[model samples]
Target: MADRFHEGLRSQVAFVTHTRDYRSAEVLPSLARHGFTTTERPHDRETERLLAQFDPDLVVLAIDPRHDDDIALVRQVARACKAQIIVVAPGPHPHGLALALEAGADVCVRDTDGGEMFNAQLGAILRRKTSPIEQEAEDDGPSTITVRDLVLDFDRCQAVRNGESIPLTPTEFKILAYLAKNAGKVVSPVEILRAVQDYTYSEREAQEIVKVYIRRIRRKVELDPAEPSYIVNVRGFGYMLERRSNRRDAVRASEAA
Candidate 1:
């Protein structure tokens, strides 16, 4: 779609369309002007070949509802490449939208909209594509911790809950951050003490001090301090931040609903 304000910058994008109608003509030129090298593919084989060769940053599938095979073609493209996909469907149908999402279309647009809206949607999708890899790298990197809504910003020395700032004392923050970063894995009181404090102490003393600080930190963060959600006592082993259980429960609830 044409965005008059758009300044062309080189970004590779692939378009899969079954027809060469006026609408397609209008859309392709705008994409080219925006610094995209557009290639039109009519079949799945051609689409896959183009994707493998050009290695596009995004794939836009303009589906023709008349062709039932178009849906299958979309699924093929999704499986064959890792590019972020945007599907343009003819109308608003909940089933079709769900199918598109299931087929790995990151975003879907109904053809009822004009070019401006389409351009804006395209821009937003591209932005998401660029950011997610960086986010995933950060998630996979060491020294980062995530538990439910809480995220310990190690570099910033702060804890955040659903984007809201949560204040914590230096000692409390370090202790929680360490536990969360090593989530789902138990760390003994001695190990925690060594990590958070430099002073040498007996294992018994370390266990006692770590327990007290953990309890205090839990009271400040946990929704139900008595029935902890993020951090859990591992009894024989020590303490671990439970993340998988919460995620599993959420998935189960969604499936049930």
Candidate 2:
């Protein structure tokens, strides 16, 4: 496919990938036609050096998420520079995408997502970066909300359940707060996406991406993620979090007696 030259991709591109041959032919030509000045790096080890040398407006990292260290490399790149960051791999792995996002990549795309899709994701992140994420703005409220054993302290930026801290990415924290604020009520993924991302998503894309973050939240907050109690999936709709009733306490007391 011919690259459509968009102003967004026309900015400088720093392409970092472990496998130089993986879709390089396709990626490079598209980037070139888009007017992006490209510099390629095989390893993220000297991400700081590369960023300084290239001074790119966009950083693209192609990696295999199956490798744990590769995920960490995304973190290194994300933290090392202010350039709009994109983590583009050759395939789809929701977990990797989520991890890359949690680590602070501005966007994640498929390596084959030609210049057009690349341009769109870049634009969204560019917009998202300019504004304060919804949760951060809302943090001016009570600062803490405690429900049964689960507590979210916006001031401390922490979520605790059963006395253990449930580590959350900024976006995950926003989703949790929004859901917990309306505990027991179903909230559509579109609502959550708009609130957390500041960008609306199509229904299809909203459902899948929100599910990834919800699953991540469940892993941290639920004792058995296989049967989640914290974030209940509302079939064909959205999600809900059922507040544990005092009935469970009474049952426990009776069993102890």
Candidate 3:
């Protein structure tokens, strides 16, 4: 099992759901099989309080079709908690999943998926989360990529905006690297889906999936996300990142200074 496969995460897990008994009966046992100390919480105002007390390594939150919060609850959970989030969407609500993703949850899984599936997927996600840090430990190669005032240091696994750190999720970092590497050209979502996600998505799915990521990325990199200077959206096509700095400009600025 992936839980055993990745021993670090077998310690603690918390699940918040309206259908607690139905889901937790299956989920808690699966977690126990992999040696997780699990907690169950109601999908109510007390969710954050319960989670804070548990302080789990991972948090699994379910969005029931019955009650919906105006993205506020999710934003609060994401901001208040230090754990990685996995939002469980009602089987029928893809938009809810999209909203959760936009709110900065690490991932979303459908209600139909079993707990074991979540365990495997979460393990892979956690592994990816740690990879940049691992790479940072032995970054004898090039450590920094500079684009104007925005600098990404692979050695430190961080992005700085005019010396201020701009935090990025792992997916955001990978997508930025791909776009920066292919700067000055329209990169279709199909390309990003295949490159970043390792699978091809239908154009509609690709756009929907990639747009949420783009929105998040823009907020981090663009001076004004409402009117972006760096990442230009081609109306019917994909996206193009205008090169933020020229090497010659850098040389000239250095000489003048």
Top model number, TM-score: 3
TM-scores for every predicted model: 0.49, 0.55, 0.73
Those runs of model 1 whose alpha carbons end farther than 4 Å from true positions after fitting are 1-11, 19-22, 64-68, 129-145, 148-257
Clashing residue pairs, candidate 2?
none
Better of 1 and 3 by TM-score: 3
RMSD (Cα, Å) of candidate 3? Answer: 6.8
lDDT of 1 by residue, 43-127 (tens): 5456677778877766778774335576676678777776666677776454564465444455556576556556766655444
Candidate that beats the other on lDDT, 1 or 2, i.e. the better one: 2
Q: How accurate is candidate 1 locally (lDDT)?
A: 0.63
Which candidate tops lDDT? Answer: 2
> Candidate 3's C-alpha lDDT?
0.65
Question: What does the lDDT read for residue 7 in candidate 1?
Answer: 33
lDDT per residue as tens, model 3, 139-227: 44567777667777765667788889988876677778777667777788889757754445568766776788888989888777876
